[model samples]
Target: MPEKSERQLLPLADSDDRQDLRADCGSCFGLCCVALTFSKSSDFPVDKAAGTPCTNLRQDFRCGIHQKLRQKGYSGCTVYDCFGAGQKVSQATFGGTDWRQDPETARQMFDVFPVMRQLHELLWYLTEALTLPQTRPITAELRRALEKTERLTEGTPAAVAETDVAAHRADVNVLLLRTSDLVRADIRRKKKDRRGADLFGARLRGADLRGVTLRGACLIAADLRGADLRQTDLIGADFRDADLRGADLTGSIFLTQSQVNAAQGDAETKLPPFLARPTHWDRPGP
Candidate 1:
């Protein structure tokens, strides 16, 4: 297992790094509660339309049921992470003037929120790639991309709303794919390429999946108990309701906190230090 310092590489917070890419809800205006929509499913209890504030949103822009979201049938909210875009849109983009103060601003702010979220998500990935020794060859390009993305996020609301986000994302994804390849290149024999594969509800308990590319794969409700997942690429993978109990994922790349929160785990799950064990997860078995 890597040391705590090594685990801290993902959400790197050095002076040279850009502003935090992690969600700081306190500095946000509950954008996720209003700018995004949800549907009645196992993840959400009620259907919601975009641009409307959630009933649980308080006047102070905080979730009324934040602490008990999962308990209150709002599991989707619990696992949702905006990568700090909420605060960026609330404080930086809008200069701390909330949507309620101006109807036009409300519409524009909501429009820009999702765009900024995607930029910030890309920043998070580029920043992580810079922290890895494997990506040293592409460090210059990664840093350039990170700076470019940061600049894009700082644009005016109109500029942000009009950003060619899909085009930008396509460019950044090329770099991310390279980073993934560099990191996983030396992991023994040819690894499984399950990218975007549908493995929902598949039984994979105690499987050896080292250095595998599980990007965009659907592992929802899959049994991953005690699986060896080190060195795996988990970017965009869906782990909702998957059992991660006792799984070894210490060296996994691109595994975000939201993905981990949506899964089930236990104390025995060997995760990187940067990733916290979900509180709702069961305690280690005796």
Candidate 2:
């Protein structure tokens, strides 16, 4: 973990506020660098086994190649976000003691990182659901889920490590799926079921894709400008090099920052407020 320091806690506006989901790297111990493994692929340049720190990790837990990560075939690192998990594990769970100093505690810290990551991810989605006007019928339940998941994230390393993330995910997923139906009910077009489909480089510009289940779909390099993607379940969908300019993803579910970062988009792209347009996404193409 990085050295512990004072971190400011922002006021939570409401149950829907996602301020807690933002990664606080400044206060984190570079858990992503030392805890997670990477493999040689199009996204990463080399194979890094679990429990081994990447060579680019700095003494202060910052990436030595951060600015040029994408240029150097470390695009995977550029897109990865811990969803505020790293800091929570470092500052709260372990009290800022890093693995380097307390070598014996390294394994437990690494174990807790992924569990906290999943819990935080759920918090992100639950908070997003609370913001949707169409999900008003389930807002109370979403709030309860959000609070419960948030509490789980704050548990001891042992408790977090033993959590049944899959079970909690299944429970929350039911509500998210229902939220999707409510949000896209008005889209009368034929709802596409592209689950696990290979739509790479497909020219889907201006297409009506509302209420679609694009789970695990490969959408790499697809031209989706001006497409209606409202209420789409984009879990595990690959968006590498996909054009999202002018596309409306207003009510999309389970979309993560990494997915948006891997795609191409611009100012006209309508996204959920929780996600930002990737800085590298200027005027875009492959």
Candidate 3:
């Protein structure tokens, strides 16, 4: 397991890296709660539209159920953090003003979130690349990439917010591909290209599935407890009844929140960052 410091710097962990991404929440204007939307899913028990502040959000930009969200109906809140983008858009972009005060900038802030999220995700991966001793061969290149992404984070809110994130992501993806090839070449031999394969009820506990392409695979009822699912392409994979207890799904791309909410797990199940545990799991009532 990585140390806390390392975990904080890398968003590719089993938990969120908000503590290291940035700590300027006090400077934010609560952009997330006021800008994002959610449906009444197993993860979130209420229906919320975009641009509407969550009912639990306080006037001070804090959640009323910040401590007991799982007990309440907001288990999703516990896992969602803005990666300092909230504060960045609030203070840096809009000059520390709230949407209630300046409604005109609310749409811009909302539009910028998905862009910033992509950048932040890149930062997470680049930071992880910096820590791998195996990538010593391309450490300088990786460092350059990391520094470039860091510089993007420091840009003015307007500039960062208006950036062509898709183009930037393409460039970053190219670099990451090289890095992955260099560092994961040895372990690549065992990678299974099970893209779109039906894996229902497969006992894959503790499997070494690094770099495997399991895109669109039916993983229903699969025992994936303690599996190393890093860098696996899980796009459209069905996780119903999949025992993800203690599984490490860091860097698993294209996995959606809806899919996770539809799955079954318990406290013992480890999940990717930005995803909360299912609410009714192991509970008596539906």
Candidate 2 per-residue C-alpha lDDT over 132-222 given as tens digits, one digit per residue, 9 for 90 to 100? 7777887778777876787787778899999999999999988877776776677635876788999999999999888888888999999
Clashing pairs in 2: 1-29, 1-98, 2-29
lDDT of 1 by residue, 1-286 (tens): 1111222233222322324677889989899999999999988999999999999999998889888887789989879889888888998889988998777789899999999999988987887788778887888898788778878987899999999999999999999999899888999367779999999998999999998999999999999999999989999999998999899998788888899999999888998666678778864422
Of the candidates shown, which would achieve the greatest TM-score relative to the real structure? 1
On lDDT, the candidate that comes out on top is 1
User: Model 2 lDDT vs. the true structure?
Assistant: 0.81
How do the residues 72-108 of candidate 3 rate in per-residue lDDT, one tens digit apiece?
A: 8676665564545666566655666777787887777
Give the alpha-carbon lDDT of every model. Answer: 0.85, 0.81, 0.67
Off-target runs (Cα >4 Å) in candidate 2 are 1-15, 283-286
C-alpha positional error of residue 131 in candidate 1 after TM-score superposition, expressed in Å: 0.4
| Global Cα RMSD, each model | 5.0, 4.0, 6.2
Better of 1 and 2 by TM-score: 1
